[model samples]
Target: MTMTAYLQTMERGDLDSWGTPEDIGSETVEGAPECAGSFDLGSPDDPVFGGLYSVTKGKYRVTYGFHEHATLLDGEVALTNEATGETVVYGPGDSWIIAKGTPVLWDIRSDVARKSYLAVTTDIPA
Candidate 1:
């Protein structure tokens, strides 16, 4: 297969592999949530990668290690900024950018939530 650039549609069924329960580090705070992802563009260690992520019903905490721009593709999620204690609810079609090192609490509101994201491991230029 030739590796080339093409437009990829984000769908809920895009994820083909799933993480073990509570595999998202030691930050799991609530119900056991399993996450799955499939990279359509690049690998996780690449400077830039794009993929679809799906999480089962649960809540967890995460500290961003990379900058990510993502849009909710399915279900709902309440994201709280640990530093400011501010919460924002995101539904399908909503998009946001999270900076590296930002601590966030993720609460899945529906049975599951899916998002399509493009992440940058290096600094994003202004």
Candidate 2:
């Protein structure tokens, strides 16, 4: 789907249909003193081919490296895009349509918490 279409779908909450349980990776950045997690969306063969994430506790600043589906179900956060130098704040019920190939930095101003649905890309075996 096109980017605009994806954004519109997310805004309308249609993207929720694409969510399912996923395995998330977490780590605490030194000095940041926060815990974070990333869910891995299986493959296209899966029923829900996307990642769902949640910050059960703590606060942190995140750097966005790749384009993926993200939603702010609760709490608050600030995101800065290095390419455009644009910063945006997200709170409950807010969502972000991150463009592909863009780099972003996130500052979890508040006790950072969120849930996201991300599309997974697959690799073909040689």
Candidate 3:
């Protein structure tokens, strides 16, 4: 038997994970929202970035054509629906899912905001 594939740093007190930097390109909202933690390079089966992501502070808009699952690890973010003008504030120990093709505004709160996420694209409904 072999015991391998372990993220020891991920088990630390801090939510921040090391390595795995991703490029959001010009899609970043503001304050250079970055993955301050674990970011995967991806593989064949799961060919998408997944891990702890964080943003210092700021607000930005995005049109999500795919589903996104996020669990707030620290700080807070206010998600406002662009279409319906609806908004929800999420904090630590909180989580949410954004529907596909939905327009959203991300309002980052706190000095440094962080979260663990798994985002992917799918044509099917959740």
- Most accurate candidate by TM-score: 1
CA-only RMSD, every prediction = 3.3, 8.7, 5.3
- For residues 3-55, write the lDDT of model 3, one tens digit per residue: 22323245433444332222432244666454455654342146355666676
Over 4 Å off, model 2 = 1-49, 55-66, 120-126
Error of 2 at 85 (Å): 0.8
Better of 1 and 2 by TM-score: 1
lDDT of 1 by residue, 1-126 (tens): 445332235323556757744564537788878888878778878999887788888888988888999988788999998989999999988988999888999999899888888899897666
Model 2 vs truth, CA RMSD: 8.7
Q: Where does candidate 3 clash, by residue pair? A: none
Q: Which sequence of candidate numbers ranks them by TM-score, best first?
A: 1, 3, 2
lDDT string, candidate 2, 19-110, tens digits: 21122122333224333344355544553345444443333333433445677765677767768789998886687776445555555656
Error of 2 at 83 (Å): 0.9
Scanning candidate 3 in windows of ten residues, the lowest lDDT window is 17-26
> Which lDDT value does model 3 have at 93?
72
> Counting only residues 3 or more apart in sequence or on different chains, how many pairs clash (N, Cα, C under 3 Å) in candidate 3?
0
lDDT of 3: 0.65
